[model samples]
Target: MGFRLPGTRRASFATKVASSKSCEVPKGYLAVYVGEKMKRFVIPISYLNQSSFQELLSQVEEEYGYDHPMGALTIPCREDVFLNVTSSFNRC
Candidate 1:
């Protein structure tokens, strides 16, 4: 699987909150990509506050024929991971 980093085209909210240092999803959540079958899937890292990881899993199941999304998960504050995340998405 390939890890796509968020870029300058990321969501406006994300871009504003993202400092020059790194990017972090508000509320401690992170987004990641996982490969299933022959395609890649986007999933929030750790777990969403109210959206629970299970919900994402269910979406993945319905869309990708898989019940789980897997990939390297890293929290905010980690410069490397943050940078990777920032480079993955597009900014408005």
Candidate 2:
């Protein structure tokens, strides 16, 4: 069975981007933009502590350096790859 580390919590990012209203991501979660379409995904803050996720953050730093225009962490990777990584992360 999957278990979460201490203080780790999962948050849902609804995939419905077609809505006129945007959903508010909770305080403990961060919004990341993924793929060519720049789809947004809200994830738990705990993922930042993972080494693999840190690699992605490195890329984000190189690209935007905390100056992300969208006010979200924009990841420069395919959506599938990001999803695959998060899927594995969820199990941890």
After superposition on all CA atoms, what RMSD does each candidate show versus the true structure?
11.1, 5.3
Cα-based lDDT at residue 50, candidate 1: 28
Worst 10 residues of 1 by lDDT: 34-43
Each model's total of backbone clashes: 14, 0
* Residue-by-residue lDDT tens digits, candidate 2, 32-73: 787788877767788889888888888778876887666777
Can you tell me which runs of candidate 1 are displaced by over 4 Å?
Answer: 1-13, 16-27, 34-47, 52-54, 62-92
> lDDT tens string, model 1, 24-51?
3445445443332222223334334324
Task: Specify the highest-TM-score model's number.
Answer: 2
